[model samples]
Target chain A: MESILQSLISGIVVGSIYALIALGFVLIYKSTAVINFAQGELLMFGAYLCLTLVVVLQVPFWLAFLGTLIAAALLGFFLERLFLRPMIGEPAISIIMLTIGLASLMQGIIHMTWGSETRVYPAIFPVEPLRFGGMVVSQVYLYSVLFAVVCLILFNLFFRYSSSGIAMRAVANDQQAAQSMGISIKKIFAIAWAIAAVVAGVGGILIGNINGVNASLSSFGLKVFPAVILGGLDSIPGAILGGFIIGLLEALSGMYLDPLFEGGSKEVVPFVILVVVLMIKPYGLFGTEEIEKI
Target chain B: MAVKCGVFKTTYRDDEAIWQTKVSKFWLALLLIALLAFPFVFQGSRYLLYVVNSVFIAVIAAIGLNILTGFTGQISLGHGAFMGVGAYCSGYFMTTLGMPFLVCVVAAGCVTAIVGMIFGIPSLRLKGLYLAIATLAAQVILEFVFVRWRGVTGGSQGMLVPPASIGGLTFNSDFKFYFLALAFTILTVMIAKNIVRTKPGRAFMAIRDRYISAEIIGVPLFQYKLISFGISSFYAGVAGSLWGHYIGIITPEHFNVMISIQYLSMIIIGGLGSIHGTIMGAVFMTLLPEVLRVISGLFSGQYPVLVNIFGAIRESVFGLVIILFLIFEPDGLAARWKTIQNYWKLWPFSY
Candidate 1:
């Protein structure tokens, strides 16, 4: 029971970070209907950029974080304009390939810029563990969960009230309808990508703080698939819930089943869950079901 | 010889003929002669033979991938894993059961087809990216099994495959393996060509163009989709078996997501639905690294830094090439080849 509780807490902490990154996926997919296979690369680039700024340029940590967000947003907007714009009306497979190509491109650039070695981020948070009854949580994990919740709430309010957010949502709902209402689909696409990049940048910083930044950090993008698929690809709140669920699932399975298999069960669990979810609930828990027309 | 201005088909059989004209048949014979002559012509150059042999294997695998993704419009990311299944099966059969090389190759293909169809079950309910992700699950799961199933797969260290042998002759060198790879490449390409031009091939195109209408026209969606998967995986299996025998070893790392993506890029860059294009794509992708190597080698003597980041440069160049091709020539190299042929055919009296 005690071990289970400990696993659950760590799972939530990891899940919140997953949710934050998954949010980036939901954003682009919602507006453009294109799954950005390069989301993980974008996250990795953000972390590396922030690291370079703080460590090499001697910038303050807070300023480097802000700089990373701005740089990431610009990078997103630029990528959308250059690579994605020409592919607006192409086939789904082509778009998918394009994003994959983008992923390879970004990965190559990252490899060239920062050799393939892992680098630790400068400590930004307090190193103490917070106690709650029988359980203890690291301060960084608490900060990650807090940041995730704050971002989620802020995004929720933005979509609920802000004009730009509503416009973006409108475009996602119906491109023709939104166009008729004078909402520029192009602008919405760029904005969606930019915002997604900002979200990914924040997730990257948080994750980098916990685990050192490396090229493999981009794999977190793949992990986000289970979370988004579980929550529903297009649902923001669903991404959060799904993230927490997958995180908890990974933790619990790691604790109880790792010994039985002699290890590597945690990595496979989310994918197993993904397969199960795809087989049983492909549309996901909260995803809108698409209707095909003849 | 007289130059024929144009050729016309009078019946369905004439239109359906694989070679529409005598000229095409003559060219086909010429191409066959060239292929048969290649190994002997390059007998002094083992490296060249090795490259061509790998190209042959890649062509077989790419043809399989094209059958599924290009012809049927079903995008699969589990292709590399399916190839791994084929390799491991053949390796196991050859080592444990003492099976003959030909029998093991066929058996491996059949096994991979079954595994592929099993994973393709979700295609009944899923489409597009959803289906792609589902196949991704198959890839991950198969990879996991390849690592964990130590008794058969030999765990992460992989398995040693025996050299391929016929009744009297054993293929132990690149020179000997070249003929074997070439024979299988020709056989698979012929089979694939026939498959695409027949009834099932037409059904695959129909599904790819628009599945809803294809189903409305009485095409069995589930059966045809599974058939596509089966055929594709069978091709991958054959290719993988040949690859294992050629290398004389099998490892899970040989078949990974990167390889799957490479195959996908081949079909995309070559011409998705064209058999001729599939071969071209395979050749282009296989030779790309060698071309890069030659170029880098030329410059490496002048600047040592060229040697250091060669891998990074190759990767970026590959990504750049894909992006450029997608943007500029989405129809691929096959279409471009046709355009050039037409241009020359209509030269001097061009409209």
Candidate 2:
């Protein structure tokens, strides 16, 4: 029971990181309706940015963290204004391909700048374990979970109460209506991208704390796809909810299911659930039902 | 439009025809003759034959992607996974069951098609980003299965497929293999062309353009989407087998996610919804990296710095190419080619 609880704790910690990345993904998809395959590369860039600020520049932790967020947000806004803006009114496939291209572009640029090598991220949080009720939890893990909860609360408050957040929501709901209401759709897209980048920056730093920073760090973007699908593509709340669900399921499957079928049954479980969920829910748990004007 | 050419009055029907003008007929025939003589024309060079064989195999996959992202208007980033399905499934049959290579190839297509349908079903319900997310999940999960399912997929090491023999005629040579791939590609392209020109093709376009209106007009959205997936996967699967047996080796690395992206980019750059464009897209995209390598060789004059510099520049520029094309030539090279051809054809009298 203790081991299972410990697994659950670790799972939520990891899931929180996934949620952070998925937040960026959902934000982009909700507002722009583009998958932003570059989301992973952006996360990769965020982690690297933090690594550079802390290690290369020797900036303090808080300052470096804040700097990374600002830098990533700017990158997001730049991408939307430069690449996505021109592709407006074009076939949707063109936009998706643009993002995919942006992913490769960012990956190559990062490779050139960082040389595709794994770098040791400077420690911000303590790496000691804390004991509670016969369960030993790592400090970083607890911090990650707490950070996710805090971000979620802040995000909820921002989206629910803030005027800018409400405008973003309106843009997400109806692009035309939002435009007619004097909300600049283009500005909303840029803001949505900026917010996503900031979320991704935080997630990248946290995950870099948990895992080493490298090109593979971007793969976390790929990993978040399952979470987004499960929680719902357009659902901000679902991004947080689904990330935990997937992370816990993965941890449990890796532990318990691994013992079965010669211990490899767990690796494919996330996708199995994804396929099953897509087969049933389709729109996902928190996604809005698509309505046709026929 | 009416045109008078050598005592023949060519109408719009003639202009729209696949084979209308005598020059077109002659050119097409010459193309066929060249294709038939490709193996011998290569001077029996195994390396050249191998490269061409690989290109032909990739064209098969490009065709599949063209159908999905091109025609059906669904984007799939997990195309490599579908190809892997065909490869590993055929690998299992060939190794364990000792099935004939021919049977295994067809079976691979069937298996991949069903996998495509299964994956594609969600596409009927989701649009754009959500569907892409679903496909990405499929890629990761399928890759994990390939890596973890030791008994079936040979784990991460992957399984090998022996070269195929037909009625005691072995295709162990690269030239023979190239011809085999060419044969299949021609047949596949021919059928695909006809399929796209049919009612089913119209249905896919209608769904792509406007789903709700198409449904109101009695187009079965689910059935057509599933069929598109089935056909696309079938092509990808067969290509996998062609690739597997030609090399006499199959590994998980051979069908990674990047391959899917390569195929997607090919169709995107070639021009979606056009079968002929798929060929251009696949050939160019597949050769894009290789061409960079050659350019690297050209600049290696007394210093090796050019190679690495060119390599880095190539990757960086390659990424920008997508964005540039998306912004400027979203219809792709095929559309540009069409416009050029039309411009010349209608020169001196602007429409």
Candidate 3:
């Protein structure tokens, strides 16, 4: 019972980070209808920047975090403008490949700058583990979960209240109709990219806190896909829910299934869920079903 | 005398010929002769022979990718896993079952085709990027299996493949393998050409251009999607089998998302829906890293930072090349080649 409680706490913590990253995917997919394969890379970029500033340059964590967010927003805006803008009217596959190219470019850049070595992130918070009765949680995990929930709430408020947020929703609803109503789809695209990048940046910091920064972190971005797909690619709340569900699945699988399967079941479970979900509910639980005209 | 500048097709037979013009036939014969004689001509150059052999294998894989992504318009990111399936299957068959090289290669391809078809089932409901994601899931799951399935896959340490041999001759040397690779490459290309020109190929194009319309017009979407996957995976299987034998080992890492991306880039930069483009793309992609290495080596002596950053530079440049091609030449190298060919064919009066 204590182990299950511990697992639940850990799962929820990790799930929040996944949720943060999935929000990036949801934001981009909602605005442009293109899945940004580079969201993971973007997360890596944020983590590395934070690392370089806070640890290498010896800047304060909060200052480095702010710098990372700014950089991420700018990166998102420029990426959309430079690479994706040119591919405005291109086929779906081409656009998808462009994002992949961007991901590869980021990976290459990260490898060159940091080398292939994995580095443990500097401790910002106290190293003590937090406990409530029999259950225990690391300070880093607790802080990461708290940070993610706070960000999600703020983002929810932003989307519900901000003018640009409404504009983004309008464009996502129908680009032609949105344009007819005088909404600048280009501006909304840039905003979506920027917002997604910021979210990914926070996710990177949180993940880096737990596991350290490395190329595999980009794959962490990829692991969020099942979450995003489960939640519905375009639904913000869905992304969060998917993240928690996947997080629990991973934790439970690691605890229970790994012993029985002799390991490897934890990694495979999410994809198994992904395939099943894709087959049964491609649009996801919260996703808008696209009605195509022949 | 028949290999002239101008020609006219007088009958359906002449029009339907693989080489429509006598010049094309002569050139093809000459190229075939050149390929057959290449090993003998470059007997001293082991490096060039090795490069050509790898290029041939990559061409086969790229052609398979083209069939699925280019012709069928069903984007797949799990291509490398399919290749891995073929490699592991053939390696297992050759070592455990003691099968002959040719039979193992064909059997490997057949097994991969079945696997591909099963994965392609998702395409019945998903399209475009969603399908790509589904394929990505396939890649991740297969990769996990390759690492964890210790009994059959030999776990993460990987498995060794026996040298391909036939009739008292072993293709262990580059010279021998070049011929083997060339034979398979030629066979694969011929099959690709035939598929593209025939009815099923047409059905693939129709589905790609407009799936709903194609469905309405009586093309079975699910069947054709599976067929495309089957055919593509078959080519990937053959390539993977050849690769396993050539490299003498198989690992899950050997076929990963990176390999899938490289194959996709080949089709994208080589020219989607064009057989010739697959060859061109495969050659370009395979040689690109080598080209970067040479250039970096030249400069690394002068600038020591180049030595440390070469890997990153190469990777970034690869990504940049894909972006440039997507933005500017989405039709790929084949379209450019066509334009040049037309310019030469029309000469001074070129439009």
Candidate 4:
């Protein structure tokens, strides 16, 4: 019982980071209809930037965090303007390939800048774990969960009440309709990308705090694919929900199945679940049904 | 839209010829001669022969990917995993089953084809990026299997493959192996060329262009899609086996998502649905890193830090090249070749 509880607690904590990363994917996919395969790289870059400001340059953690968000936002806007804009009229595969190319480019840049070595983040959160009866949660994990919940609520409020957020939703719904209503679709694209980048930056800071900064952190982007797909590619709530589920699934599998397999099961179980979900519910649990009219 | 040139075809046979013009036939024959004479010409240099052999293997794999993603329009991100299936299967057959070299390679390709078809089943429901993501599952799952199935695969240590021999001729040396690879490369290219001109090839194009419309015209979606997958994986399998034999060892790391991306870039930069493009892309991508190495060597003498930057630059250049092609020349080198050919053919007069 204690082990199960521990796993669940850890899973939720990890899942929160996954949710944040998935939100980066969701925001881009929702507004621009382009899946930013580089979301993980964005997180990685953000972490590196934060590390540079805080560790290398000796800035305050909070100030460095803000700087990271700003830098990430600029990157998102610049990438959309330069690489993605020219690909507006291209085929879906071309656009997808563009994002993939961007991912590779970012990876190369990161590797060169950081020398492919993992760097431990300077301590930000307390080292102590919070105790509740027999359960203990790392301070970093608890803070990460709190950050995710706050982000989710903030995003919800923005989407529901803010004019810009509503405009983004409108563009996602129908580009022509949104344009006709005087909404700048291009501006919306830029804003969506910036927001997504900022979200990814936060996730990166949290993850880098936990796991250290490295080229491998970029793989977290790949891991988030299962989360985004499971929740629904175009749904925000689905991203969060899927992230938690995959996180829990991974933790449980690591605890129970890894010992039996001698390892590797935890890494593969989410993909298995992804395949199964794809087979049974192609659009996912909360995904909008795709209908084509000719 | 037809432009009249000095050359004319008098019969259907002439019109349908793979090399229609006399000049083209001469060039093709000359190229074949050159390939056959290459290893002997560069007898003192094993590295050149080895590089050419690697290019040949990559060409075969690139052509296979083009058939599926470029021709059939079904994007696959799990191509490297399929290659792994071939390499591992062939390795297993050679080491454990003690099968003959030729038999193991063919059997490996067949096994990979079946596995590929199973994965292709998901394509019947998924499309585009969704299908691409689903294929990622295949990549990850197969990678896990390759790592954990230690009893057969030898785990992370990998499995060693003995040099292939036919009758009494052992292809242990780089020069000897070059012939084997070149022969397979020629055969694979010819097969791919023929497939493009056949019924199934046309069906693949029809599906790629418009699946619903193709189905309306009686093209069976599932059958052709699976066939494309099977054929593509078969090529990857054969190429992979050759790679294993060439390296004399096989590991899961050799067939990762990065390799799949490399193959995809080959098709993208080479030109989708163009056989010539596959060859061009494969050779270009295969040689790029080596070229970068030489450049980096020059700069490393000046500043040691430049070495690391150069490495990153090479990778970034790869991404940048693909992006530039997608933006400026989406049709790739094949389209550019056609443009040049047209310019030469229509020379001395503005068409």
Scored by lDDT, the top model is: 3
**Fnat, one value per model:** 0.56, 0.63, 0.81, 0.70
Alpha-carbon DockQ of candidate 2? 0.52
Give one digit per residue, the lDDT tens place, for model 3 in A1-294.
Answer: 988888888889889999999998999988898889899999999999999999889999999999999999999999999988888888999998999999889999999888878887888988988778756778998899999999999999888899888888889888999999999999999999999999999999988989998888998778988999899888999999999999999999999989876897878899999999999999999998888975
lDDT per residue as tens, model 1, A62-178: 999999999999999999999999999998888888888888888888888888889998778888888889688888988988998999889989999999999989999999999
Q: Show model 1 residue runs off by greater than 4 Å.
A: B1-3
Which CAPRI quality tier does the interface of model 1 achieve?
medium
C-alpha DockQ of every model: 0.71, 0.52, 0.76, 0.76
* Candidate 2 interface RMSD, angstroms, 1 decimal: 2.7
Candidate 4 per-residue lDDT over residues B1-351, each given as its tens digit: 765665667899988888878778888999999998999999789988888889999999999999999999999888998999999999889888999999988999999999999999999989988988988899999999989999988888998999888789889999999999988999999999999999999999999999999999999999999999999999989988889988998888999998998999999989999999999999999998888888888888787887757768888988888899999999998999888877776665737
> What is candidate 1's CA lDDT for residue B344?
53
Give candidate 2 misplaced runs (Cα > 4 Å): A261-267, B1-16, B36-41, B300-315, B347-351
Cα lDDT over the full model 1: 0.90
Q: Write the per-residue lDDT of candidate 3 for residues B1-351, one digit (tens) a residue.
A: 333343467899998888877667888899999999999999899988988999999999999999999999999998999999999999999999999999999999999999999999999999887899999999889888888888998888999998888779899999999988998999899989999989999999999999999999999999999999999999989999999999998988999989999999999999999999989999999999988988998988889999888878988999999999999899999999988877766555565
Clashing pairs in 2: A258-A263
Best-performing candidate as measured by TM-score: 4
In the range A1-294, model 4's lDDT, one tens digit per residue, is 988999998888889989999988988988888978888999999989999999889999999988998999999899989998898878777888888899989889888878888899877899988898978888988888898889888998999999998999999999999999999998999998899989999999988998999988988899898998999999999999999999999999999999988988988999999999999998887888798766
Query: Candidate 1 vs candidate 3: which has greater lDDT?
Result: 3
Judge candidate 2 against the unseen true structure and give its global Cα lDDT, from 0 to 1: 0.83
Taking every candidate in turn, the Cα RMSD to the unseen true structure, in Å, is: 1.6, 2.9, 1.8, 1.9
lDDT for each residue of candidate 1 in B201-305, tens digit (9 for 90 to 100):
999999999999999999999999999999999999999998998898788899888788889899999999999999999999899989999999999998897
